[model samples]
Target: MSARTLLVDVHTHLYLPRYASLLRSRASVPMIRSRADGDRLIILDNEPSGGRPVGSQYWDRDQKLAFMDKHGIDISIVSTANPWLDFLSVSEATSMANSLNQDLEEYCSSGPSFSPTLQRLYGMGLLPLVPSISVPTILDEVDHVAQLPHLRGVIMGTRGIGKGLDDDALEPVWSKISDKGLVIFLHPHYGVSSSDVWGEKDNGHVLPLALGFPFETTVATTRMILAGVFDRHPSLKILLAHSGGALPILSSRLASCITHDPVVASRLQHDARWYLGKLYYDAVAYGAEELGFVSSTIGRAGKYGTPTTEAVAGSSHMTFGTDHPFFPPILDAVKQDSKWMSVVENLKAIDGVRDWSEAEKSAVRGQNALKLFGLN
Candidate 1:
């Protein structure tokens, strides 16, 4: 394992008080229901009774800082949690998005310092993305996020505007974001929505969350790639969640499918596999082998447009993340010093990769994030 220089988590989340209150007031699947133990968050339709426990960790800034300190994470780039404005009407979502962006600016800019030049926190803002929202309105929100000093990016779900990310409506928004140089933290929420595939089991959320989320991300990203979103706005900076789901492992398969299709192969400027190198991924895959494999896929992507078939180490495109508060210690930590299993697993994965040197491990741990976000 390499000695730690700095640790940055790009995949952390927070539901600010304003947003939490909105969820608390809702009567739908995305709402929060109060329980005897605490507030329970029911974001997913199939998330089972009692949902998941919601407490200070989801909202309180102090708790966020405590988690960072406990995990030795020096800097965190937080985004709004899932089901973000997805369930609201256009007017309501527009108002809430504005207030939330301002709140995020305040939350991040007012946080304590990790160093003289850097604050411990930065954030990704939101957009009013309901189906009824016009492209002009979406562009307005993008402009709003770009002007916020503390927000370095915008976090979004697979459903872009009304349709999926490949929809033509999102092209202007993509171009504006690309021109502004803001990173897009693309996350998953609707997760394939096919209950029959999992059968009628009482097996908790394991199937939907573990398998469904990643697959949804893969499908969404593939659609965007096929639509040539990357080729249109080549400068768009995007960070994919959950190691780009299964996209890394399936890139070659997708390339083969694309090539075998006479119509599809004629559209793209570069091979489909080349796009893997253009995106960033989170180190939340939970195992050393998966992380290492994802790194190889990303590293090897550079060879697609070049003559050389040699691979390169791609730790620079992967950033460490805990997905904290979502996956707490399964067994309650007896001592305050005990780390969450999720965080530990990700860190160990970075260390346990067979051929990664100290420098590569350190980059995945934090340095890559610093450069990607232009953080000091």
Candidate 2:
């Protein structure tokens, strides 16, 4: 094993006071409101509970530090949680995004008043992503955010420029983002189409959280590949959440599908497998077996001197993460525990993979993220 540290949580979130206040003021899907009980703060959603409780951890910097310390997270690249700027009007989205980005920059650089430990925090900036916004406006925000000292990248949902990531209208946005060397942290906001995955009933957010989120990432990225985005911008760095949401398992299948399609083949300069190699993945798979499979399959090497059949056949493309704040413990579980079950599970999975040296482990935990996002 190489001499390196064991853990870094690249995929965490902090609502940040400014963004939290914005959510509280609104009355829509992304808003926050106190329940009739008056004591409980809940995020507004399209479900029966409205949303989960909004606590200090979601908005307070002190709580964030404490959570990180308890969980053994040496570093965290925080970002706004889901439903980011998607519901706002064009003008409102742009302004709020700028304000939120500025606030995040400040909080990450200087510790929040309540907690000195927050000085260790790093973050990815938010962007205005409403459908009514113009492409140039979106590009401007991306360029501006890319320049912030503490801003390592931009957190974007699967919905690209309105018509999903495959839409040609978004090419310039992708081009500008790629050219700026800003890592695009692709997350999932919209779940699978209801008709295809669920009935008209509530399942306590399980379907969306477990299945819908990862599934959304898979489809959006596949569309981006099919559209030749990677072929056009080979340097574009994308970090897919949830270990690429079955992409490792399904990549070969996707490649086969693309290869068999005459129309897709004729338009692209390279194959789908080639594009996958250019992408990066977060180590968020739930099990060691899954993590090892994803790591080996996505970028494994071939016999002799030939390029591996898998697109991304190297360890550098994988990084560590913990989807925090969103997957808090259930009501009956221990609330004050230092480590979250969700976080520990991911760490254990990565550690349990056989034949990985300490250096490779350290790289996956934080070094890979540091290199990819330009974090020191």
Candidate 3:
């Protein structure tokens, strides 16, 4: 990796101090508990053990910069980790959303200077999308996020206004986001329940995190497309985590199914696959082959359109990411100053992808994100 080639991590997370404090004060499943060794974070309801260890890497700015320096990441667009504002009541969520957004602004804007030429940090703000929250309130939060200098977008879960993303109630929210020119980082929290697959064995979170999470994203986005979200808000910018979570592989099948169903066959303005080109994907698939395949799928979406012929390069629509603080190097895998396997694999995947020129690879590494987030 050349120093001249910028690397931007769009999928990084930070459990800001305020958020961690809020979690510690909670008494329920998503709370944080302090133990002998360290604090433990339990965000998922079905976490196998108690939860993963919480550390300064989650909230410490210097630690984040050090990790970035170790991995050669030039900039990162941090987002609040999963289960954001999910458990809070409407009033609490709204208030905290405001506070967290400000905290995020401070976290990004107050960072130490890394390079004279580089602005190292930016963020994706949160919204109060909990149930019973009025659209006006959410819209106001959107405006607030837009006004924040260091906030480039907003992170959201599969659920939109209590229902799934396809809910009609989210129409106003989507409109406001699009109108504000804010990218929606669509992430997943509550993955699909699969007792049938996992059975009773201590399979842990392997199934839920890997398969269930992406499957949830696939379902939620598919519903949004089927409900004519893209048709309604053509300018909406969404960045999908985990390379759209099996969406590229399953798009053709979904299109076929949509065509076969009379009720939905004539609803969409274009083929189901066309929307892939309009969206952005993070290169966190962990394999060059998987990244290449999804890139080709997204690249081909333009040609699949019914009446539009906008050809898109798949690589141009993808961005680099490291899901830091979530997947750190194991003790056995650690070498002195060694990069995490997770980050290395993703970087290697982008570098090893077939048919991508140096310029295209640079775009995937950081140029795309720079443009997507309007970063300097």
Candidate 4:
């Protein structure tokens, strides 16, 4: 259709066989439980029927390619979805992480032969961030992933090698990530666990997914900013999910807070606003207004400084994504035939941005990610 545009979806997901096996072996919330209908994934502790519908889409390569073809997607930079390796013992996590990485690498590289113009696949591998594991071992996995031929980077949760991402212990990991030129698909897994806040009513998973997930990413990133991770590892490229989880909206507020606080004002290299350039946002917000607001905010980041083009450094930071397989079409036709509504919504968001030039839209559609992930 529009092959010249090189449409790429950077937010798709798949759990490798080994990882699925590990989840199945477990009796926990993040496991795949047997059901009369079929297996279902339960990521949250309390979710019973609220867990994701598990199907071949979770593991089949042909299904992934078919989804891409149906959506007119040229490439998919897939990542393992949430609740990654954080729940295992140090030794168990280490082994599982390596196995999962290898499995993912094999999957991404060894796909069934297809035309290069359609459905070329690349991936971000998982890291073993189980608590108390040595930093060098973590670095080892970082290096290991960087070396994988088809692995573009590592997808990580907010929690670092046990400590949070803000922990000084992660400095080495950051340094290595920067040095390796690996993109960090900085995703959120742990949402706020406040059951009381959900109120006396059962609103189901809506409250946690809608509010808690984004807020978790916002807090984790702000914590990293306060800790001066961006200042130290300025070259570190992090692609934030859910359109950076409200960071675009809160960046100015964060900067305002940083300016007023005596302790916070003296901390680092640049304002909280400036850090937006140092970050990348996935266009998974699913609205023209949301995507435009995200792009405008990232581009607006540097205005707080003295004066320079650096202010608009984040304008091209947006890369298109479809949180696929998770948000499948509910309608019969969309479900049976061509495009998925979820993917169509994201594409419409990109296509509908009134202020964006064709070049800018094209960049967000695929070029930005191709350059960022070294796919070119």
Best by TM-score: 3
Ranking of models by lDDT? 3, 1, 4, 2
What lDDT, from 0 to 1, does candidate 2 have? 0.76
Mark the 10 consecutive residues where model 4 has the least summed lDDT: 110-119
- lDDT values, one for every candidate: 0.89, 0.76, 0.90, 0.84
lDDT of 4: 0.84
Clashes of 3: 0
lDDT of 1 at 44: 78
Tens-digit lDDT track of model 3 for 15-41: 999999999998887989898988899
lDDT of 1 by residue, 10-123 (tens): 999999999999989989889999988888999877677669999889989999999998888999999999999978999999999999999999999999988777888999
lDDT of 1 at 281: 95
TM-score of each: 0.96, 0.90, 0.96, 0.95
TM-score of 4: 0.95
TM-score of 1: 0.96
Q: Write model 2 residue lDDT over 1-376, tens digit each, in one string.
A: 1215635577888787777787788666567776775423443346556567667878787777788778766667888887788877899899988988998888788763212322367788887877868988988898889888878889999887688988888889889988888888899977775655778766787887788889999999998988888778878999999888967688778778877888786767665555656778888886888877877765542321135343344567788888887677655556555457678888888788775676777788877887787754
Which residue pairs collide in model 4, if any?
none
Better model by lDDT: candidate 3 vs candidate 4: 3
- The local distance difference test score of model 1 is 0.89
Among residues 3 or more apart in sequence or in different chains, the pairs in candidate 3 whose N, CA or C atoms overlap within 3 Å are none
**lDDT of model 1 at residue 95?**
94
- C-alpha RMSD of candidate 2: 3.6
Worst 10 residues of 3 by lDDT: 330-339
